[model samples]
Target chain A: MPKTKAVDLVVVGAGPAGMAAAVAAAEAGVEKIILLERQAELGGILPQCIHNGFGLRYFKEELTGPEYAHRFVQELKKHPGLKVKTETMVVTITPDRKVVTTSATEGLVCYQAGAVILAMGCRERPRGAINIPGTRPAGIYTAGSLQYLMNIEGFLPGRSAVILGSGDIGLIMARRLTLEGVRVKAVLELMPYSNGLNRNIVQCLEDFQIPLYLSHTVTEIFGEKRVEKVRVAPVDKDFKPIAEKGFDLSCDTLVLSVGLIPENELSLQIGVELDPATGGPVVDSFYQTTVEGIFACGNVALVHDLVDDVSTESALAGRAAAAYLKGEIKTKRWLPVKAGRNIRSIVPQRIVVGQTTPLYIRARYPERNATLHVGDGQTKQQVVSPGETIYYTLKPEDIRTADGWVEVSLEGGRVHD
Target chain B: MTELTCIVCPVGCRLKVEQGKEGLKIIGNGCRRGVAYARDEMTAPKRMLTAVVQVAGSERMLPVKTETAIPKAKIYAAMEEIKAITVSPPVMIGQVIKENLAESGVPLVATGTIAGEGCFKPLEKSLGSE
Candidate 1:
């Protein structure tokens, strides 16, 4: 490490979370802040996502991924207190808010901040992560990586494709490949219903007449140099593959959009306690992690389908960091948050005393006419799906009036409040 | 009564469209957009087509889309035209690449930019072929 740069806050990963956090921290009167991004560009994955349907919540208009990311970058630039370092990968972090980064230009740089925010975001589940018995093939890719190759690098993956997992990314790729004149046979999902938004299911699959095989999983991949075909089998209610119900589909490529895992290597290195359900740090209402002075938000906290939510959550982290620097943040007492009913997980696993916190939640499964009970209040949900993030706000006064902990559960419910 | 889900938003409002004496009555919409979506869906369905077009100078493909929504009936034909067409850079955003696509009278325009010769590998020299 050369010169140790000291700042009020240090944010890792320059995606929506990091960018928004840096901007919020600066705007909240933090004079010095540093945002470190591993990519050569500051916008993160947004550059490669050329499709629309982003920024509906934050910007009030539909914009492409690059356009949505640019909004925060433009906002971050207005703050003179913030410095963005692209292509700088943060290799390690100490429990006491020290970040070590490296880039081609700057051989090794260190940042020692009053508060550190982990906005490392999440990564797509690759082929190796899942068990698909087959010969190693070259045409396999995660749906996100394929989007980058086709959209950013400007090249096609293959001629005909068989995509596994009917997640939003897979559905989007199905439409994208079809638009590029590639043949997509079917999109397979292990669940009964799609793990994507209904709009995506309609526009991406129904629009193109692509079949979606529910309760199905890819059993095997048969290829050597390049993909030739794949075997898909219908799974039971418990997700056990029925070999007798297996069928072979001939295709040249396979794209998997199974799931995402939060990028939390540095968070773990910093010794921040992680929430097993969300695969991210256990945070408080202020986005403060178990290790004081360190915070987390964005997909690093929970996988959000919309980038707009990531921006909103990360901004809270930024403000909290600034408040910590000013000694305005409370750390004496805490209220534990638990998921209840049909809910899967809740971010901000705990709440700081007398603070307003927005709870980001995910459902256990699909349900209609759903109501989320948080504390004493109930939020009526028109519909709920495991694919989307459901949020309920727990006011400070509500927390002050109630027990030491808050509980959030759905109709059939898992509890996190 | 016909049940349909509105694709206007992530909410995916489940709408009940019924034929009454006054024409069509829509229920279960969360917003006014749902009403409009239901109306259009029952009569003339339309969709915005976004796709990538091959570029001559750059190995990068040009992202293009219909300037406005096109009737659903013409989607296949529009796709056929889009598939057959190819253009060279430097293409500017909103520049019309093709006009009156599939008799829909909607222009297919560039949604993204593609830089010209100096930086790109010649189109023929590019790897990954059909």
Candidate 2:
């Protein structure tokens, strides 16, 4: 039988989100907090992301991924009451907040925690998910996987590659490969607009003179032993491939940066309700999910574009968990928040009245001079893109007049050129 | 007139630069930093270089970056210099690796710590490979 111990709080994963949650919980005076990470060391994916342009918001200074994570890691060292467990894989989490973890050092252990915070972050969508018709061959890797191989393991995946999808990682990897003497043939995006930030498009692809083909998709991949060439074609408005306009590009590797899905297997194990739109657990303003004493934040809550927002959101979850342990949180009325016109997704699907609630929203499409209508209050934005997150705080007074529900909509804007 | 996207921050303001009678004129900038970014980008572009260097007697690689942005044209040359050098372990983060990288006048420094052997284990193979 595995040894069982009681703890005040148990944090799963040690990424930016998990690390911030643990640090914030400890700062709230929660003693005997255990942070579990499946990897050998901490910092999660930040260690492998060796690029600049992080920490511009939270720290007010531009930093690399590792540097941004190291700032919080240094804070984790200050709390002696926090127990950080590395290389610990959490196998199951029960509804009653029982956490079961396994590791080589500590074979098997069970922790009955007062509150459990889900911060497992997210995972990359691979080739199988997108159904790119291709010969099952080697030399195909996700953008993130390729990044880990080169930046961490110091191995080039291939000499030349064609990257599909202009997600930030793909764009960044295009430049990284170019700097390392790899020939990046081009970046192809099925959508008319890229899902990555504008800065990434300008610096990573345009800076390196890599051609970006909009409304283009890879129709077929041809290679027996390794990826040798791929057939790409332009897409119509309906996203169907135009076979006549197809062309071939020779490359040794195919890097996919299509999308990222939140890692919520553990969240599902405990039967936490999920939002199909966000593909993550639905939470309230306090970052607490439908299940009592369980909180979700960061990518597990919703895929955020920036790590700065992840740290801020996870810290709220941590403090809320601390409050839950002290019995300060009460179940009151939760107003259903709806996504109206032009809104792709909004976090905090439910919110309690009488508190300043922050809402994170993503537009369905890029628009110019759009006005965001949240309940009775409204704000204007010069430009809003699906690639960027829109942050709005609903004041207590603003929601007081709400008749049991709040709707978020964008109006008075045309599609951006 | 030249058009560019400001990469100074995530806001990513799009700017238009043109040579006016006075000097250079920038428009559509959301902040002051955007103006400076456009001016520098138009005149002499610079970018921060980040790469991994091999650590002697270990399979681990230490991540390093320039203290500041260097001239954009010298990136490949700077990468060559980075590839030619190797450092011993027991190195701390922020330790200077080179005083001036590719004559760009920016110091190259380690961004991660590489402790002695037996204290930290090398990471396992990445799951990206099939």
Top candidate when judged by DockQ against the true structure: 2
Docking class of 2: acceptable
lDDT of each: 0.83, 0.89
Candidate 2 structure, TM-score to reference: 0.97
Instruction: Please identify model 1 stretches exceeding 4 Å from their true place.
Output: A400-402, A412-417, B53-64, B76-130
Give the range where candidate 2 chain A is weakest over 10 consecutive residues by summed lDDT: A395-404
| Model 2 residue A119 lDDT score | 93
Model 2: per-residue Cα lDDT over B51-126, one tens digit each? 9998887666788999998999999899999999898877777899998999998999988878766524532211
> What fraction of the native alpha-carbon contacts across the interface, defined at 8 angstroms, is recovered by model 2?
0.44
Write down the worst ten-residue block by lDDT for model 1 chain B. Answer: B121-130
TM-score of each: 0.91, 0.97
Model 2 over residues A1-417: C-alpha lDDT tens digits?
A: 688999999999999999999999999999989998898778888988899888988899988887787788888878888888887899999999999999887789999999999999999999989999989889999999899888877899888899999988989999999989999999999999998999999889988899999999999999999999999999999999999999999999999999999999999999999999999999998899889999998998899989999999999999999998999998977788889999989999988778678899999988999899998889998889888999999887667454778889999989977
lDDT computed for candidate 2: 0.89
